[model samples]
Target chain A: MNKGLLIVLSGPSGVGKGTVCSVLRKKMPDLVYSVSATTRSPRQGEIDGVNYFFKTREQFQEMMACDALLEHAEYVGNCYGTPRDFVERTLAGGQDVILEIEVQGALKVKEKFPEGVFIFLVPPSLDELKQRITGRGTETQDTINHRMTVAEEEMNLLSHYDYAVVNDEIEAACHRIESIITAEHCKASKYLAELGELPAAIEKA
Target chain B: MNKGLLIVLSGPSGVGKGTVCSVLRKKMPDLVYSVSATTRSPRQGEIDGVNYFFKTREQFQEMMACDALLEHAEYVGNCYGTPRDFVERTLAGGQDVILEIEVQGALKVKEKFPEGVFIFLVPPSLDELKQRITGRGTETQDTINHRMTVAEEEMNLLSHYDYAVVNDEIEAACHRIESIITAEHCKASKYLAELGELPAAIEKA
Candidate 1:
């Protein structure tokens, strides 16, 4: 059986990445969403294993030391990482695995697995992204402005990724992501080595 | 607006390409089957432009002289070729064009338009291909054997093509082809370029 592909999705805050991922998960049931292992305590209603693999700081540090994590980073003094074993097991079962990580973690994952498909999602316009951040009403104006500036820096790295989807509309963005997954399977490099062996086998037989 | 993609199909005889192309055309109306131009006289009920752009030997030679033909070859003293003008016009109109041509013509078209997706349709197995060819009972045993030999040669050239679809089941083959076309549109080369100008445009306004 063909192993499932690894797909990494990264985008700036307020780009509707979560909404797109939700719709995509509903459409593709077999998809495996990689839940991060975090040292931070779970908030209300957050399941331990289902929401995250809530680990102790020592446990997280040990995993990082042993190279057990595909990617890990400390954010605001809390450690978050993707467990490599779970991802490998899911991919071995011929089911696609989606990693929703930040730009830094995404790049780290790609360095380890060069074949992983990296997708960068973008808002339709910078103004629109600002409007979205402000509309949330949770962040102060200063915080929103800071995120908008950070988003511009992230957009500069868009050219480094494999493909970019404009998260202007939820359905359309999901469709583009689905199409990207389908298309990556059609790559010649994936089958060329197998095809090369066929001719030799035929000749030997 | 983004122009439609062009796809070229090539395979040895008895590979079930005709059935695959027929099903694909019905499934994708946006896919336009390119009609070839020929120096051979039209058979009864064959319409001009629809069936073929019937041309005299001199006219065909003139097209070759002016580089009007994308690809051309002579078989049994009759000439057949694809006109570049008609294909470009169709693609410019936002319709995906498919050329069901032989391997030689397919290669030529690839050289002229490197972006054109080339698909090679193969049988499930060499033995299966021979069985289908012999089952037809329209050709002599010697002819069937010769075709099987030719099929092997074509398989050797499979690496030169972009994708290979095994025609074990008609519907399955069509689905693979459709998936390939859908996927090609999501190529990093194509999608990333669109993102390039968007950021600059958004920042300017």
Candidate 2:
């Protein structure tokens, strides 16, 4: 059996990343969504190590200091980071791990774990993205405009990704992601070790 | 629409490349199987262009001289070559073209068209490969040994391929190939142009 892939799926705000991921999970139930350790207090109904790995600032900092986190970021007064141990164990157990993060965090993860399959999810068009953002009805017009600007910046970073999936339709996007994972498992890099053992296997045969 | 991929599907003898390709073509009716120009006389029921672009030795040599053939080789007494024009036109029309060729010809195609996706098809095991070859019942023991030797040589060239599909089950192998084609379309190289147009399209929106 092949080792599971470390898939980093990132997109700009309001590209339906969460919805797409939900659908993807239904298709690939074995996929492990990485839970990040955060210093912020967990909201109601959020389970420990499920929604987020709730941690104190001291614990988060200790994790960072010990290089236990794959990537960490400080946002507004809280430190949030993906724990390396969970990801490694999941991958070792032959279960694919998905890290859903923003572009900045995705790039940070890329720097630390370059072999992870980095996927950038995009909307069919900017108009659709703006519409989706507006449909949320939680943000002010000014905030929406700021997000659009940020999205523009994020689009520039698409070159850094290995694959770009367009969220035109939920099912189509999910299918593309699933296919990407299946295809990635067939990549030469993933099979190199097995290939190295081929001569011995053949000799015995 | 994205331009179609030039996919080179290669395997050692008796790996079921043809059966796999036929099933794949049934699933992907739009896929164009490349027609090679050959100097050998066509067997009964072989159409001129459908089976092969049957050409005289002189005509095949002319194509080779004019760089019209992507890859070509002389085997036994006859010459065989992939018609570059047919492949280019098919891809330009946004239809994927599959070139089922031997390893040497595949390597030649790779040199000529580096962007082409090279896929190596393999059996589940070398014993299975030998069993399939002997199961054909057409080869002498010496010829079977020679073929096994060639298969070993071909396996060594696995490093040159982009992906490897194990032919344990035909549907599973075909599905993997289909997934590979889908995932490759999502690659950054293929989407860079769309990503470039993103800003302009967003501004217009």
Candidate 3:
């Protein structure tokens, strides 16, 4: 069996990455979602190893010290990280893994796992992104302005990704993401082992 | 608007490239089929500039001298070449162009146009490819052996391609090809112009 792919998905704040990912999971049920490890206390309804692997700061620091985490960062006073063991086990069992992360975390994953397929999700347009952010209705103007500035910075990081999916419509974006995954499997590098066996196989035939 | 893509499709004979391409053209009507310029006389019902742009030996040589053809080769004592002008114009008009050529001609085209997306069509397996070749009925055992040897060589060239579409089922293969085209359009390199305008567009908004 072929080894599963390691996919890193990143986008700006209001690009609706979570919704796209949810629909994509429905389409590709076999996909493995990487649950993060965080030092922050779990809120109501959050389960250990389901929503997140809640850890104390010392435990999170221990994983980092041992080089057990794939990528990690401190955010809003909480330490969050992706565990390497679960990802490797899932891939070794021929199941693809997707890490939906912030741009900084995604870039850090890229540095550690260059072989992973990096995808950037974008809104249909900047105007659409602003509308989505505004549609949430819970944010103050100050928070909205800060998010727009951050979105601009993230959009500039498109060059770092291998593929981009524009979330004009949820279904269309999911389809593109699925296509990218299928196409990535068909890359020549993925078949090197089988291709190498061809000459001998032909001689026998 | 984004510029169109230059796509090269190649596979061993009997891999059903022509069939898949015909089906693809039906689905993607805007796709431009590249017509080769040939010194060989057009067979009955083959129209000039449609089947091929028939050219005299002198005209063909002039194109070669001027480097107007993207790739050319002498085959079965007839000169054949892809005209660069037609392809460029179609792409500039935002229409994707598909070039169906043999492996040798494809590698030659790659040298001149590395930006082109190269796709290899394949049978599900080597045994299946051999079966397809033998099923062609017109060839003797010796002729079949020669073709099989050549097929193996071409399959080894899979590394030269960006994507591989297995013709196990025509519709599935076509769908994959279509997906690849859509996904390719979303690549960052294809959207640099639009991306460059994002900051200003956001500032104005």
Candidate 4:
């Protein structure tokens, strides 16, 4: 069996990565959602292994020192990271793994797995992104302003990704990502190395 | 408006390039079919400048001498070439162009337009390709053997293409091409160069 694809979906903050990921996983049940390890305490109803591999700061630091994480970052006084072993095992089993993460982690993953498909999701517009952040009605003006600056910086990171998908609507974004997946499968860059011969691919076709 | 995409579809002889192209065009009305200039005589019901830009041997040679053709190849004592000017004009107008040609000519086009999206259409298998050629009922045994050799050589040229699509069934093949088009538009490689800013693309989204 072919080793499964590693799809990293990430974008700027407040760009709806989480929402898109949940809907996408529902539509594509075969794509395994990678669980991360975090030092933050789990919220109510969150399972230990299902939602995250919750750990103490010392344990998280140990995992990092052991190079057990694919990518990690500190956020709001807590460290979050993707466990590298799980992703490798799932892919080795010919099941695709999707990591819904932030820009920094996604870029870090790229450094390790250059072959992984990196998709940078963007909000429809900067103004709209501001509106979404502002519409939340919880963030102060300073927070919103700070987010806009971060969003611009994240968008500039678009050059590092393989594809940029605008999260304008849920279904449309999902469909475009689905198409990107299909296109990547058909990419000659990978096909030539994978099949090694036309007869085999033709026969399988 | 963004410039249109130039899609080159090529494969070994009798792999259904013409058949698949016709079906794909029907499904995608916006894709412009590129007309080739050929030294071959017009067959019954074939119109000059439509089916092909019928050209005399002298005129075809003159066009080649002037480097007016994107790519040209001779077969069965006749020359066929794509008119570069027409394709250029169409794409400059933001209309996508589709070129259905043999492998050699497609490779030549790549020399001038390295950015062109090259798709290699393959039959399901070597046996199936052979069956399709034989099913045509027009080749001598020597010709069949010769074509098989050429097909193998052509498949080897697949390393030059961006995609390898199997012509298993016409509809499935067309749908795959359609997905490729959608996927190409969303490609980050082109997006970074085309849009230049996330705000622009996001707003459009």
Candidate 5:
């Protein structure tokens, strides 16, 4: 079986990445979404190993020290990280791995694995993004304002990514992400070794 | 409207490229398949400018001298080339341009337009390719053997291409090509410029 490609997708909040990824997973069965390992307490309905690999702070630190984490970051006094073993295992099994990480984590993964295709999802417009954030009604006006400021900072890092899909529509963004994954698999380096092993009889003739 | 992307696709003979490209073009109305300019006489039912530019030797040479041809080659005492003007115009008009040229021409276009996506289509296996060629029944056994030899040479250059798709199935191959094109447009360089120019009032606040 053909080995799978590693895809890293990053975007600001309110870009509908979760929705797009869910739909894409349904469309592509071979895709394995990498569940992160976090030190935070699991919320209700969040399953261990399925939602995230809930780990103790010491365990997370040990993984980080041992270089077992692809990327890790601290948020609100809790640590979140991606374990390298699961991703490698998935790829070894011929399953494509998707890491729906933040920009900082995405950059770290790119630094470690240059072959990983990094894609940033963008909102259609700042106004549209602000509208989406405000429409959520979960955050206070100050929190919404803080997110808008963070979005600008993320947009500044757009140049570092391989591709940027505008979240104008969830379907279109998913399609773009799916396409990048498919195209990356078609790179020549992956097939050259197999092609080189063509039967000697065929080669000689 | 954003300018369209330039895509160049090349593959060994008997890879079902024609069928795949036809399906892709039909599915994407905005895609324009570039027609070549050739000194060779048109066969039956071939129309000028549609099938080929049908240029005289002198006209072809003039194009070559003026550096108006993106890529050109001579075969069997006839000269064939891609007209740069038409392709540029089509791209400027916001229509993605698809150049289904030979490997050499594809390389030339890549050198001329570094941003152009280069896709190399490959068959599943040499034996399958030979079978397909023989199944066509249009070529003699000797011709088929010669073509197979040529296919090996073409495969050697696959490393230079950005993507290598296996033409095991026409529909899948077309889908892959279409996806590559869509993904290419999402490159950060293309969209970041527009995003950068958002009104300063919105950006600063």
Candidate 6:
């Protein structure tokens, strides 16, 4: 059986990546969301292995040393990473996995798994992004401004993505992503590995 | 607007490329079917330009010399070729064009237009293919055997295609091709050329 796709949805903060992911999950119930393993203590209601694979500092480092994580990063005093074993197992089982992560983390994942389909979700425009960010009453002017700068930098890295979807509307973006997934499956490279093992024998027959 | 996609449908002679294309046309009414220019004398009710470009031998040679033909071949002392202008014009106008041709001609078209989306349609199996050819009921045993040999050779070239869709059922095959088209549009390379110019200026903003 063909392995499922590792679709990485990456974008800057407040670009609505989470909303898009949530919508996508509803649209595609079979899609598995990747759970990260982190050394950071879980907040209230966060479950180990579900919310995250709660790991000790030593355990996280060991995973890193063994190359057991697809991508890992240290934030503040805690380490966070996606477990490679779970992803590989799920994909091998022919179930697609959606990995929603920051732009930086997504690039790291690409280095480890170049075959992964990288999608960079962008807002329709800088002004729209600012508006969306500002719509959040919690953010102060400085925080919003800081995010705008970061978003611009992230947009510059758009060239690295397999597809750059404009998050103009949630449903539209999700539809486009679905089409992209369908197309990816149709791509020759997706099935060539399986076919590569058969052509010689089949031709002889 | 982004330029249109050049979708090339190819496969073995009896694999029902024409049937799939016909169904696809009804489904996607906007898809332009490429018309070949042929030097053969027009048969009854074969309208010029509508059915074929109806070129003379001298005109066909000029097209070949100028690289104006995407792919050209001679059979039974008559020449036939796909005009490069019609395909290019249709694509540049942001309208997708579908080229239904033999596996050999599709490969030739790829040599000229590397960006063309080459799809190979195949029967479910060799036995299925033989059954389909025999169902035509017009060929003698020798002709059927010869065609089977030729088809097997063509199937060997399957690796060259960007996508290989099984023609188990006409509707199912059409659906697969439609999904492939949707995915091709979502590909990053499709829009990167237009996006390339913007990142520099947008980054400065």
Winning model by lDDT: 4
DockQ, each predicted model = 0.42, 0.73, 0.56, 0.54, 0.57, 0.50
Q: Least lDDT summed over 10 consecutive residues: which range in candidate 2 chain B?
A: B193-202
DockQ of model 2 vs. true complex: 0.73
Error of 3 at A126 (Å): 3.1
- On residues B102-154, what C-alpha lDDT tens digit does candidate 5 reach at each position? 77778888888988888999887778888988997877788888888877787
TM-score of 6: 0.85
Candidate 4 docking: what grade? Answer: medium
Model 2 clash pairs?
none
Best by TM-score: 2
Against the reference, the lDDT scores of all candidates come to 0.81, 0.86, 0.84, 0.87, 0.82, 0.84
TM-score of each: 0.85, 0.91, 0.88, 0.89, 0.88, 0.85
Model 4 stretches astray by more than 4 angstroms: A40-56, A137-142, A197-205, B41-51, B197-205
Where in model 1 is the C-alpha error above 4 Å? A39-46, A55-59, A74-79, A200-205, B38-48, B51-59, B74-79, B135-140, B195-198
- What does chain B score (TM) in every candidate? 0.83, 0.87, 0.83, 0.90, 0.86, 0.83
List the candidate numbers ranked by TM-score, top first. 2, 4, 5, 3, 6, 1
Top model by DockQ, which number?
2
Local error of candidate 6 at A100, Å?
Answer: 1.2
Tens digit of lDDT per residue, candidate 2, span B1-205? 5678998999887898878988999999988999778898876667998868899988988898999988997653578799888898889888899998777789999998899999999888889999999998877899899888888888888889999888999999999999999998999868886445656766776
Model 3 lDDT tens row, A65-137: 9999989987545787999999989988899999887787899999978989998998877889989999978
The residue-by-residue lDDT of candidate 6 on A60-169, one tens digit each, is 99999999988987643568789889899999999999998778779999997899999989787787888898996666798888888888888778889988888999
Q: Tens digit of lDDT per residue, candidate 6, span B1-205?
A: 7789999998887999878998999999999999888898876767897667898899999999999988987743578789888899999999999998777788989998898899999787788888889998867899899888888888888789999887889998898899888777767666667566767656543
| Interface RMSD of the candidates, in order | 2.8, 1.4, 2.1, 3.3, 3.3, 2.3
Candidate 6: lDDT of B26? Answer: 94
Residue B16 in candidate 5 has what lDDT?
Answer: 76
lDDT of 4 by residue, B1-205 (tens): 7888999999999899988998999999999999889888886777997778999999999999998999999864678899999899999998899999889889999998998999999787788999999988877888898898888878889999999898999998898888888888888887777776656766564
Instruction: Quote the positional error of residue B98 for candidate 3 in Å.
Output: 0.7
Q: Between prediction 3 and prediction 5, which has the larger lDDT?
A: 3
Q: Write the per-residue lDDT of candidate 3 for residues B1-205, one digit (tens) a residue.
A: 5678998888886788877988999999988999889898876677998768999999999999998998997754678899989898998888899988777778899998898999999888778888988996766898788777778888888888888888999999998888888778878666666556656756665
- Preferred candidate (TM-score higher): 1 or 5: 5
